[model samples]
Target: MLELDLTARLGNFALEAKFSCETTGIVALFGRSGAGKTSVVNMLAGLTRPHRGRIAVNGTVLFDSARGIDLPPERRRLGYVFQEGRLFPHMSVRRNLSYGYTRIPAAERSIGFEHVTDLLGLADLLGRRPGDLSGGEKQRVALGRALLANPRLLLMDEPLAALDQPRKEEVLPFIERLRDTLALPIVYVSHSMAEIVRLADTLVLLSEGRVEAVGTIEDLTSRLDLRPLTGRYEAGAVIRAEVVGQDEAFGLTELRFAGGGLWVPRVEAPIGTELRIRVRARDVALARERPRGVSILNMVPCRVEDIGAEAGPQVDLRLNAGGAALWARITRRSLAKLQIVPGARVYALIKAVAIDRTSLGRGAGRFLAGPAEGNLEE
Candidate 1:
């Protein structure tokens, strides 16, 4: 487990960051630019020392102002992957990876070169130089080099931010493989909600150098108050569902959550596969009752759990359909005209196309459990 409660003054900006993450997969530091995400990671890396508070990983104190204990960068045993892959231009991929692997004593190195090569799919690029590799390939080589170092904790600062969309997509699978297979604790930093939802297990939302909120990806994305931080355009609910059925002729797969069965673009998983889907509030429309002749393929009965504060022209109504949480964003005029109130039954309308295929994720091991019935109001 990683425990960090730090206070650092950087020029005119003061950073008071604190959050604890389980020693598991990815714990993402998510926020806008200049939110002090990098400063927090730097403190953990021993690059930037906090003026106050403490930092520890699995009970080992990395820093403590009260106790006057602070470890230097080289002694921290933490691997850092910066925004760009800082590989030696002169070295081959094999030589670059070997640079880190050779530094640690033979007994201290648990992750071997063969495992890193196979896990990162770096077997083919072993002889290639950094100049010949793509942006994604270079990052993979960087990751391999870091893992071979066998650091206690891995710190990644916007690793995917430097890559284009296609390159980002290419590198994502390899990161997912690392999250699933490696036992190392990873602290990932990103501004993209899509990346956070896909890879992060715990989310530390930072705003203006302070920790705004800390929760799981599902909890934070579903929060109405954090909408401004989650980005209005990207705000939505993340629902965990299981693949129940498929329509091969139509190229669609049916995923059942507590809310209902949604028909999405066909997934290659088996029937019992548990997956996570993002339901953007923008795509949801509310009706007092289910439409009779509507062309929309997906509609579920939901009740307003709560109404969020009015932000500009729109208002968010948090809804619960068959025990699953969903959100709908509509104008203030529509909310008033519909007389929508808490506990009121309404039909949540959604279009399958609006469900972002790129944002779909694989849940961690276990499936979600709740009232599986699709029609809560029926």
Candidate 2:
């Protein structure tokens, strides 16, 4: 487990956060710019000292101000991947990765050069210098360099923040592999909701130098306070589903969620692929019955679980579709006119255009293939 209870003052900003997690996968620090994410990371890396409190990772104490015990950044055994690749412009990618490995005593190195290369898909680019590599390639090299150090924990501060959409996409799968394949824990910092939903297994929400909330992505996303942070365009619940099959003639892929099967835009994934999908709240429409003439391809029978207060002009409705949870943001008048209430059986209508194609992943496909069981309450 990773734990932190620290306070620090920087110019006009003050950070006082206390949270702990047993996350073995990626733990994301999410918030807007100037939300103390960088500061917290710096403290964890021992680059900055907190005025008070303790920091520990798996029973090893990194800092304890009361006892005046603090380890230096290099001694913290953390692998940090910064926004910039920070690769040696004159050195080949191979050399950069080897440089860190060489610093450690040969007997102490847990990860070997070949293992790093294969894990990062860097075999083809080893001979290339940073100048000759694309942004994604350079970042991979940077990640490889960190991995060779055999860090107990990995700290990535918006490593994809500087990249274009394509570059970000290129690096994401590698990051996912890092989480799934390795035992090392990760503290990833990002303001993007899409990244959090796609990558994080646990979340620590920070705002203006303070922690707002910390929990699983589903738990935090369902909270009203966090809705505004996600922005209306991206506000939604992430669902894990399975790929049952493909409809070749219609150019569509069929996904099975809690209540029923959903046909979405064609996705280039194999059968039995597991995927993650984000269904935006605004894209969901509630129906009292199965409509006959609607063009929507995805409609699942669900019951209203609860309703959140009207924020701005819309009210957020939490619905339980079989065992999976789905959220919809509708006008207050609509909720009243439709007489929507808890336990009311309804159909969740989702347009194909509203589903984010990029957020779809293999993990979701596997979930859809399995029989729906247990409640996935948000």
Write candidate 1's Cα lDDT for 73-142 as tens digits. 8878898888899999999999999987899899998999987887777888999999999999999999
- Residue-level lDDT of model 2, residues 1-378, one tens digit each, is 999998999778889988999858889999889889989998999998999989999888999998888999888888888889799888988899987788888887888898778777788898888999888988999999999998889999999998999998788877876666678899999988888777777889888788888898777876666776656567787777777888899888888876678788877667777677778798899899899988998889899998887556678888888877788988888898999988899999999767765566435322332222212222
Cα error of candidate 2 at position 123, Å? 2.5
lDDT of 1: 0.85
Q: What does candidate 2 score on TM? A: 0.87
Q: What C-alpha lDDT values do all the predictions have? A: 0.85, 0.82
Lowest summed lDDT over 10 consecutive residues: which window, candidate 2? 369-378
- Enumerate residue pairs that collide in model 1: none
